[model samples]
Structure formats: structure tokens, C-alpha cells
Target: MLLNQFLVLGAALFAFGVYGLLVRRNVVLILLSVELMLNAVNINLIAFESYLVSAQAVGQVFAIFVITVAAAEVGIGLAIVLMIFRNRKSANVDDLSLMRW
Candidate 1:
């Protein structure tokens, strides 16, 4: 119920997401971690919106925009990952070197 509680939860989620992003080797896991981070941000935005009691619901609107962007990101990211996997037969981030000349 408290704003601090929501903030703490959001921070914890964000930290976990960052850890996953940095430590994971699988591309899918990294994408999931990014989603987690985005969800944490959504939580914070809604929490702030509720706490501030604004008439326009700006935080919720922004969160919706973020969700939309994140969806598009995941779609594009997975498509690329799928193509990479098809070509390389692996999804590990360390194995990717398509950008190198």
C-alpha cells in the first residue's frame, strides 16, 4: 500500500533483471530479462500515478506507451534471434559474431 514498498519492489525487480541480463548467456534469457526490467518500470510508473493522484493519469499512459514499445521490441528481437539461430544453430550470445568483419 505504501509508496516506499512499491519503490522497493520495483528496485528489486530491476536489480534482478539487470543481473539476469549481465549474467545470462542465452539470447532468449536476455530478452526475458529486458522484459522484466520493463515490467519493473511499469510497476514504478503505476505506483507513482497512484501515489500522486493526478487527474490526467500520466503515469499509466506512459506505462501503456512503454508496454507498446516493449512489445514491438520483443517482436523484432525474437525475429532477429530466430534468424540468427537458424543460421548458426545456436542461441548463445557468446557465439554471435555476425557483426564482425
Candidate 2:
């Protein structure tokens, strides 16, 4: 209910996302981690807008934009992952490096 509570939740979500991003080897998990990070950002933005600037909807608008971008990112990321899986026979992050060679 409080701004601090929302911020704490956002921080926790972001921390989990960061950990997942660093530890996960699968491309799909990495994408989910990114989505989690984006959701955390949205939580922060909405909380700030509601508490700090109640009259303005800028934060809400920005959160909507972020959601839109996240959707597009997921679409593109999944497409790329599918392509990688098709070409490399695996969707692990390490396999992506082999593309360079």
C-alpha cells in the first residue's frame, strides 16, 4: 500500500531477475528474466507516479510504453531463439557464441 513497500517489491523482483539472467543458460529463461526486470520497472514507475505525482499520468504512460516494448522484445527474442535452435540444435547461451566462429 505504501510507496516504500512497492519499491521494496520492485527491488526484490529486479534482484531475482538479475540473478536469473546471470545464472540461466537457456535462451527462454533469459527472456523470462528480462521480462521480470521490465515488470519490476513498471511497478516502480506506477508507484512513483501514484505517490509522487498523482495529477500527472506520465509514469503510467511510460509504464505502458515499457509494456509495449517488452511485448515486442519477447516476440523478436523468441523468433531469434527459434532460429538459433533450428540452426544450432540448442538454445543455450553458450551455443550462441559458436555463431561467431
Highest lDDT: which candidate?
A: 1
Q: Report the C-alpha lDDT of model 2 over 3-78, residue by residue, as the tens digit.
A: 9999999999999999999999999999999999999999999999989786669999999999999999999999
Work out the TM-score per prediction.
0.94, 0.92
Clash-forming residue pairs, model 2: none
User: Model 2 misses residue 17 by how many Å?
Assistant: 0.2
**lDDT of candidate model 2 versus the reference:** 0.95
Q: Write candidate 1's Cα lDDT for 5-89 as tens digits.
A: 9999999999999999999999999999999999999999999999997899999999999999999999999999999999999
How far residue 67's Cα lies from its native spot in candidate 1, in Å, is 0.9
Local distance difference test, per candidate? 0.97, 0.95
**Clashes found in each candidate (C-alpha, N, C closer than 3 A):** 0, 0
Which residue pairs show collisions in model 1? none
**Distance (Å) between predicted and true CA of 86, model 1?**
1.3
Best by TM-score: 1
